[model samples]
Target: MKIYHNQLTKTLAQGFIPVWLVFGDEPWQKDNSLSTIKAAAQQQGFSELIRFNTESGFDWQQLMDEYQSMSLFASQRIIEVEFSTTKVGDAGNKALVALAERLSEDIQHKHYANDVIFIFHGDKLDGPSANKKWFKLFSQIGCYLPLYDVELKSMSHWINQQCQTLNLNLAPELTQLLIELFEGNLLALAQELQKLSLLFNQSLITLEQAEQLVIKQAKFNPFQVVDSLLLGDCGKCIAMLDQLQQEGIAPAKIIWALHKEISQLYNMLNQLEQGESINQLYKQYRIWDKRKPLYQHALTHIKLPDVKQAMIRIADIDLLSKTSSEFNVFILLADLCITLYHGDKTQALSLKYG
Candidate 1:
């Protein structure tokens, strides 16, 4: 049966399934869903769980061998297969195609005596690629649940649900602000909830607790560095860059992150200008998570036009590093901070990349 993630509790209450396919791009949901299902399966007698990564050099026949094997000293077994984007090639296709063609016989029949539960998970499936025959087969024959990532527009609703799960009360305005502050970090967001829930003990989670607990500790993901720089907080931005370099985070990886943030910020500011309500705006624009701050901080800047221009220069620098022989990503990152800080003379861009 094709099931949406929201129906998870219902599905588990109903009992076990021989096959479950947890496919999605949402890491938070994916992790939670799989854990719930796996827990239920284990409690119901599924033991000796076998885990496989798509990147591993295991062949198609080896996959089948594991699937067909009986559990040693256990009543039932769970086999989990994680399919990455790297699995899109010839070998991956072969593995998937083989499983799709034969699993019906193995799972439906009782030849092995020991019950076997199979779980196939994929995070990188999207667009035309998700419609493939092998993938379609899993959903068609058994339990198929897909979890989409949280977008800014849906973040409030999601956060509200998350709060409700923790029995925390929150004002609508405060909820929106919390989502803005936490952005796309559901795991971190959940962590913040637990931290507050212990203190509040099911009482309402106020905006104040969120600020001190969530906002204060949230290490600015390097994703926000460019926007932080563009907003003229050079000191914090540069300090962040230096910290990242010191931590051994690759310069190229940092640039790519900044590039994504700049492009996202440019769009977010444009949407904010069209009189979009905080709720309506997040939905209409795809800004979520770290990108939320780009617009938040941009509001404190001169204008969107200046931010866009600064982003263009950042983009040019990125292209140069990738295509040109000289790949001084460090210098390009520094220049990015300098441009964003000076682009708007209204506020002083602190040159600290901490």
Candidate 2:
């Protein structure tokens, strides 16, 4: 049966399913679901775990062999397979189908019902792959969970739920602030909540406290750099870029944040140019009242063409960072930010940076 990440806890309460396929790009949900399943399995006497990663050249037959083989140390065992990609080849597809068939037989006969649990974890499976024979077979016989990223509309509720889990009390305004600061990054939000729990120790956290704490933590996040860039602060953007590089943050992450904001800005600019109401667009995008001025300033100073060119430069930087070792992504990123900030006046400045 197919279920969502939110359904896992209630499903586990009913009983442990023998086979599970958990796949998603959302790291927090995927990891949480796996932890819940593993805990449930352990409680049901799955004491031994055999893990396999489906890296290149992995033998599909080995999984079959392991499943068929009995555990020596423990009566019940869990077989966990982690695949980086959903595209298991022909041999793997056959092996998985065969394994699912065996599990179905076991379920029908009530044989080895509690002795073995199979889990397949990986990135999100595309729509076409979900209709494949093996995947369909597994779904018929076991639980298939496809996790998704938390949408911005539901982020505050998610934050509140997480705060409850951590025994931290955050006011509505504080919760909204946290959501804005994290910018839809669940892992970072979770970490910040964990930190708040440590510091506050079950006490109610005020907005002032949250502001102070999040600002300190914000030093390491790429969002700050993106904010600086969008606000057209070239000096602050360059400084934050340097800080991120010094702190060992990946260039791809910084590039991704910038690309996302710029893409949104480009879209918003087009909508405004087409005579759409700014207030309506802001509401549609869920832009907070405080952030309207930032968007307004950026739209006023930066041309739509400049935003488009910056996106192209971002793409180039991403490609060069991955494909070429000698190219300096940080320098390229700084150059892009300066170009976006200064537009046509960046010729001598871009040359100096280059």
Candidate 3:
């Protein structure tokens, strides 16, 4: 069965499955899900725990041997296999299929006879993973929980949910500030929430207090860069790019943000030129009231042709970043920033490619 992380608890309450496949890039979700499953299994008298970390030249026979081996004291057992990647070799594929057969036999014994639980976990899987014979067999008998990083649009809601758990009441502005500072790093957000819970003791956290106490987890996020670009703060934009590079934020992520915001501007600006109502376009794009002013400012300063040239430049940056390791992506990004800052007065194509 395919289940979400949020649904895991309810699913566990119904009954424990023969196996669980929790795979994702989100560390917190993967760790929490594993802990939840382990705790639940432990409560049900699956006291014996065995773990195997799969790597190069790992002996699959040992895993099978351990599963078949009877413990002297503990009646039930939980067998966990941690994978580095989803690419299990031919031997691993055969071993996992065989293990599934054993688990299926135990499932059929409705007497809950000789219960042996299996947990196979790894990082984010590709789409093709679902078709693998081992994955198919596991899904048929157990459950698969695939998790993704919380997106920027949903960060505020996620923070609110976390605050509720920590019993920390945040002022509205503090929530926004937290989103800006800790947008992509969930682990840092979790730690900060824990700190606030301890410090505030259920009191409301105002923006002032947050500013004074919260250590900036991220120096700046991509959204802030977009804001700087929109407002034509070329200096601030370049500085942010430098800090982001120093902080090891991926070039691809920064490029993605630039591309997204510029694409939106191009679309909106093109439509506005054709006599499309700005108000209607805002409604169509679901632009927030606060951001409407930014778009308006951008429309006054930026020409549609400039926006088209930017989209092409950003696409080139995206391709170079992916294909060439030696490509100086940040230099092009800085040039792009300057191009946007000057609007049509100084063209990017004339500056870099003309």
lDDT of 2 by residue, 124-190 (tens): 8988888888888888878999987776578888888887798998877888787665654687778
Error of 1 at 31 (Å): 1.3
RMSD of 1: 8.0
Best by TM-score: 3
Clashes of each: 20, 0, 0
- What TM-score against the true fold does each predicted structure earn? 0.62, 0.66, 0.71
Off by over 4 Å in 1: 84-88, 106-114, 126-129, 171-173, 216-354
User: What ordering of candidates by TM-score runs from best to worst?
Assistant: 3, 2, 1
Instruction: Report every candidate's CA lDDT.
Output: 0.69, 0.81, 0.83
Expressed as tens digits, the lDDT of each residue in 1-354 for candidate 1 is 888877987988886676788877666788899999989988888877888877656665667888766557776888898875523666667767677667765556744343778888887557666677777766665688878656657878887787778888776767777675566467777777777777787776667765665552223456557556655677767766765665567667877777776666666667667765655665666657765665556555636766666677676666776777555566557667666546655224422322
Q: Lowest summed lDDT over 10 consecutive residues: which window, candidate 2?
A: 345-354
